[model samples]
Target: MTLALAGGALAQDAQKGGTLRIVGTADLDHFDPTSGALVTTNNFLRATQRTLISYHASTDEEERIRPVGDLATEVPQPTNGGLTYTFHLREGAMWNTPGGARQITSTDFERGVKRMCNPALGSAMLTYFVSLIDGMDTFCDGFAEVEPTVEAMKAYIEENDISGITQPDDLTVDITLSETAGDFIYMVSLPTSAPAPIEVLDYMPDGPEYRENFIASGPYTPVDYVPDASLTLARNPAWSAEADPLRAANVDNIEITFGIQPDAAIQQLQAGDADMVYDITIPPAILSLLTATADDKVMTMSAGRTAFLFINTVSDNNGGALKDLRVRQALNYAIDKTALVQQMGGPAMAQPQSGIFGAGVLGYHDFDLYPSEGDAGDPEKARALLAEAGYPDGITLKMPYRNQNNQPEIAQTIQAAMAEAGITLELTPVTASDYYSKFMTNPRNTEEGAWDIAPVGWAPDWVGGAARSVFQPQFTFDGRHQTYNYTDYNNPEANEVAKQAINATTPEEAARLWAQVDELVMADAPVVPYYSEQVVLYRGPAVENFQPYALGGQGDWTNVWLNR
Candidate 1:
């Protein structure tokens, strides 16, 4: 097995000191690491955030997903029946502070976890910690009652304590989990678990004041940030290449300009006006043009991102038809995934998916329960299933899709296909930024039938052995904070198996258990899995070392330097 951050620098000439321009249409969901849920946010944070363990910008498949030390000295092994973990802060993982660049302490790490449960703009992934950490749920429940004001939040954090997290010394951080989890290290690798400086408590989490007084624990510090418009990054003087292994800090500065269309953004890159893309994938036409010309700058890679449609079981639309497994299965069988694939930029860019786990993910295996000839849906079978489910007169569903990229076209394709089987779709196009924050993650939207179905995408939170990343967050529900589990789907039997997989002794054992959970989840038919997508990334002429990072589905910001 390969170690994470093994020679973190990409294989490129040691060229340095140039501005890398990033163009996109969406602003970051949140500036604070704790609240960041988007892949683009993680990519940007790789430049300025430090977690206990982090992924390296390595090209090797095995090395890229491995967890490596960042703020922590190393990836620590668990003791006490895999329930307890102790990690020491490294020598020079410093935070850009008011007084000076101070070494981040274990106290900062503990504070970061404490801030994860803050009622105001806290982490969407807080359930991962609250469910695993021994006393975190109790702390979060009490904190939820406090005023959302900075003083109240700050006082609660300082006054209360989580028995699961402790600081033995200024540098040593210890954690006690409720159960053994083989993939626990990958959870901490998330940007949400990064250490937070004490200065952040003065402002609402990720508010204007917090962004203005932003601190840096990684290579770059953000400045001059205008919401959905532009942001600038400057090299942090405190960042030492000798002290850090995950990022090389090759560029002197970064300028992110939002609101650029995909076509215009790619044109800028071709014209050498921009060095990289920010939020959008390359337009299919542009990808074709570049690939036809055998352009060296154009590269297609897999980042384990899969697109699917989540069925609203909680919705009462059409007399709650979606709550029936047969109706969901009918929707699955009726979707012409082949047409969906063509709309996704052809066979080269996407492959039809039929199960909960996307292709190449840890638990993924080829299995389409609703088999169709030529992979082209069976409308007759779908009509029969709908009739059996008491929707013989046909049913209508409201579906929302992100307006950005080719989703609008995909939504139309789905509408046209399902129409053949007596399923009427009233499609609603949504803003990319608001699609998750305002719609899908809101359980009320599901209950109120605001949207009975939606096309959504998922990329692993951390890559290697990340079955939980795909399943636990997006599928299972424990009645905690409603998050990626948009459909209110819950299977206690499968969830228990997930717990068993998490505690499995070996990779093979865990993978076997994960596969079982995948099969079980599909039997319930909560989501209509569509296609596993291939990423098309275009780098500017001046961009160098544009290595593919699995987590971000784009070039690694920590590795890319500018030849210009």
Candidate 2:
């Protein structure tokens, strides 16, 4: 009933394919993995094109997942409180160029993780993400008082008496944390886990060259990378066919052009000029066109991402109207998620999200687990809450938003809902670039309070219960937590619980603790809890075996085929 794959089937099946051209809206400021602050962009570069410990694709109900032999031969074994991992280097793994010059080794991983943790690198990644390891927090925090020089960082590592990490051999690494954390393996499974060559790194001049020459031991190797413009990757010929399809790339070469001048990239796809559009949020007009006119060319999938309206707690009005828990609760009840999703083709075309982590993620908690505090279309209750908060009938608030067309539409829907309960809204829309450069760059400025409320969104980096990391006291970008705590939300108890969740040893235990934190956040209502984002994708007809998941984008491109 089934045909077995022929020997050298992968290579035999390979047709020395045409270059797959992927166009998108944004380009990496730097190609270094640690430099990424957003999830979708980071995962696109890390998951399909690069190799690491684990990979995930889109989800229907279950998390469609795949992971190749990255730097590990098997599931990591834990000693004390961290990991002791051994990677049996697949001899075939090499850089994209010939002569197998980029062959992977144990030493590469040592250098990579060390570089990731090094304070001198000034990577935001090392701070919050890697702190699950015992000594990493101290190393990341060491940069605070004194200049974190290379010698100082190296000496700090050399002198640490922690049981968290050890490089026992060139290919083996061991870690012991402060406590036995449940997601220990998942922590190491991050993009940070992928190793970099110390040799090439030795030549970096503490500048952009560090990003340009960023190497890969995964499926593709960087050839040329232009910041805010384009990135090109060629296949690693030495990459074995037997490697995990989850982490491999099938195409011979890949070209990703960025900052594609809004709507230009979509035009290319409509003209059949691109293999795919990786991360650009397609506009509704283009989405409708794809469905009605180019149905054959569009492939849609659900992504594990969430989008919501965040209220700044530090606002001059103490988060303005949103400061009132009842008002915040009323806003959550006012929006029609079903209708909003229908217009954007959200839940149907992309993964429908309600909870923070989205469905199928390992540690996700059901919204029902906590008492529902917001308006569920109860006009009477909404009016009662608003009245209790002493809001007058003529209250108006200006909510600033990034100019995603759907966002304004969603805001209007909320406006209409609130209108029914006697409230008016002045929906303020601005360009995405301006929105980020202004309000998001610094939320604490005196003038920043001009905007009373706005929609905020987040996409997680991994599948672990650490999804709660976003709620950690406040969200942090780079080393400065104050800027992103736009809500200026401060709860010592919630912050403490977030730390506990990070170090919790089991999902049951972590969930129990995080549940408390989630309840606290939902109750605070700094931002009205809204729907999660769904990633909608369009695949070309020739592309086959395109399984989608949250963490991995472009699916498992390694086994995909272009029908010749």
Candidate 3:
């Protein structure tokens, strides 16, 4: 869907040579592309790094999303029964180096994949590639056994190579997958798959040294960066506009300042102090004012992001109350998604979601297993189920939620609704940074019954055919646990269907199988899917040609030029 703008469009021509200033509430979790999973980090990486394939940063909705080649000459067609892919690197693609610029080769691409398996790095997206690439799982397992040091990491990479990837020449790279993946090309577009220079192997991935001494292979290079402070991007002298088709590089420089709240960032944008708020959703309170005053600058776009509450089925909180399916179903029925939507700033900000997959993702359908009345929830039915599950006198549940954004407000709304169904929710507020990394994902926290339910959100790693993006990471647990699979849930029936869907020849068939998987998961009720959110981005008057990318869920920094 197109971003809904409040005012008239700006001048069409892209004017060059100005510094684009950006402000945001949170700092990037990591600058190392392989280790970071957050969208903000991806936005930062898009400016300073190039992937083999990338989405075009276009003003047109459809053309903007179609994946195109960046470092490669073009999107490769699959060979060898859809199990192999061959990529031809662009002729003039170069990496910014200390001496000068050096040609980026197929070896750099292989190095990028190997970095993903670094144990100390803890790449969240590794699970997506491990099984898909032949011998990758074995590589990761071996890497895990080694000491987490630069010497060990370097030796590991030098000794072994992924059996599936072969660099026939400096420009040609071939990849073979363990199974057929129709959307495998989409995975290469992600930041995790971006090429890394061999020089970076000397420094630990995701460590302080790597973050500071980062090299660039994209249109822009990071000239300066501070962990929680600010970052400055300047044009890469070695980068050729002809080799890359995705980014326009209209702006001469980009300045991103972190730790600015949404309200403050909006004020800066209105006062002409900032060009845009990088990846920060406008607060609902200010969204109304902007809609009336400067509608054209306000952007409300559909993002493939879903907000849900994970029920701790494995945790023995409240004497294993959540272990009962009736109780889990009761929790689902008790949440008033309609009220939750209102609290999150009306229909413009979010739509009530019934399943794990949000709209725009493949396999997403309008089917609610709980069948609430107008999505307002059925508290009476929930109480009956609770009673059936041996909680006739009601139950108490501990919930932890991020303090930032509208999560606190949403939690309060859920608390009010659950109370009506004889469930009292104890809310514990946590900072946005520590919420997921420190508290929710910690196994000790789960074992000690620290929380019974927690507010969480997920966005597909890439844009198209997102069945594996949603299911494998969040639902099914094969041999290893996925980072976002907070509940440690597994269903054999759903897993079997997901495997079939992954191997489906056509998009239509995959979508059908994914829809069935959604039905099965919703029936199990491991998590309460509440709302699919829309991102609201505010741009200053000077910001021109502000087109939002689906993967970044924010305006493309490379395309927009400062008119001022």
Candidate 4:
């Protein structure tokens, strides 16, 4: 089915005054917008926070994904040779407070941008904006020198105003970028860029106090929150539908129950106990049953997430085998992607991916620099390369994989394929909570050769013109290491191409350059691009206006309402 039609299904007459129930396995990582990076957290934030710009919840894929003004009067056009953006804040956009709603101002927006650089918050998205915004990197550097206290944070923010952001009046905010970025407007639409009141600075960022003292500027406000237990959101009494154009505010309350597994969530959905399965995809075991019995309720689409295996070249494990380019390339050739797709629950769940860019992002092209035999892989070629790399007999490698989300089965499938090419893999399982934050992202683990191969995944930070979003954080390391860039791989030529792509005047020109960079990075084989996935979600029968959001690749909560 076309995405437009599927999105249109949700727009039947909207009903109001029902509690929407949501269930998920894991709790949110952070309630503060600046600190959270997970998409699930972003989904919750959508109801409580308002960015300067945001996409309209629509049925048309392009219109639904494109950025438009939320707090701002409209999406601003870049001036000063694409180096400057001027935003006029919309009047009457207010923050929900204890006494009454307070007007949201340009200072609030500036405060939000400054909070991202706070060392205590440790925002994963800071890297995307640090280099582009004028004097932002310097501000961040100065912030790192201070103690992580509320007093110190307040002093830092008060002493140093971002030179680029200037507010001449209460409503006007002018921003100048260090570099020309065509995608700067899109970056502002992210949750990290959501405005917060200066009063929030009284509490420590990301500390317990901050979460407790959370304020809302959107349609809903968090009334009660217990981590790993439950979260209850009610309509912000101060919020007016006339002021905000994006959210319908159809449901009166949103109740999210934590610690429910995907299978259990599915059961709850089928039994009409739950309205939606939060962020978890439908489990593979019951996919066919739901497809036949409840096809209209199912929604599937490709998000920007790409899953791959990171080959640690810096590690000296297995006689520093991965350090050789031929060995790395052989590892890429060794895996049968076709089999890997089936292990991930058929093409509906995942398709073989050859390059870094996924399907949804611009500049994404289909090409495999390293050719495989009908996506089954060339074991013979892999064996030949292994012999050439001085590992004719066999090479024993240690691999780590996440225990959740059918990853263990995918790891086994890769292990079997690698065995055919004389590569023995020892698999280590890590829990979902610690996999990315503690294990894979820990540079100490890579330096100590804890594991040679680790399965990892990434989704574009934003939707369109996201070539820089995909390549910069994962592939290139300037000086400071990105959390997800575990290998610490840097290529000057590839980096230069990526820069050109970012600076390209037209989208077509940028896409060509990005595709070129993808080919260059793939030749290095720092990672094995296994598969890109299309998530499958199921909504309760009573749920209506369940438009599939392109960013989260799931039903948009802001657009959904209860039919009953």
How high is the lDDT of residue 45 in model 1? 87
Candidate 4 lDDT by residue in tens digits, 476-560: 8878677778877888999898888888988899989999999999999999998888777788878888876655556778778
Q: Estimate TM-scores for all models.
A: 0.96, 0.78, 0.95, 0.94
Candidate 1 vs candidate 2: the TM-score winner is 1
Ranking by TM-score: 1, 3, 4, 2
Candidate 1 total steric clashes:
0
Task: Give the per-residue Cα lDDT of candidate 1 at 351.
Answer: 93
lDDT, each prediction: 0.85, 0.55, 0.85, 0.83
Error of 4 at 420 (Å): 2.1
RMSD from true fold, candidate 3: 3.1
Q: Count the clashes in each prediction.
A: 0, 14, 4, 1
How should the candidates be ordered by lDDT, best one leading? 1, 3, 4, 2
Instruction: Give one digit per residue, the lDDT tens place, for model 1 in 133-242.
Output: 88998998998899999999999998999999999999999999988888888899999999899999999999989999999999999967888789999998777887
Among residues 3 or more apart in sequence or in different chains, the pairs in candidate 1 whose N, CA or C atoms overlap within 3 Å are none
Candidate 4 lands at a TM-score of: 0.94
Candidate with top TM-score is 1
Report the backbone clash tally of model 3: 4
List, residue by residue over 1-564, the lDDT tens digit for candidate 3: 343221223334568899999998667777888887887678888988888998866556566568888888999899999999999999888988777899999999998999998877667788889989988888888988989999999999889889999999999999999999888998998899888898898898877777667788888987888756788999999898887777778899999998887778888999999998775767778888877786888776665789898988887887899999999999899999999888878987889999999988889999998878889989999999999989999999999998876677888999999998999999999977778767987878886889998888888888877768888888977777677787679999998898899889888998899999999999999999999988777789898878877678888888887877
Worst 10 residues of 2 by lDDT: 2-11
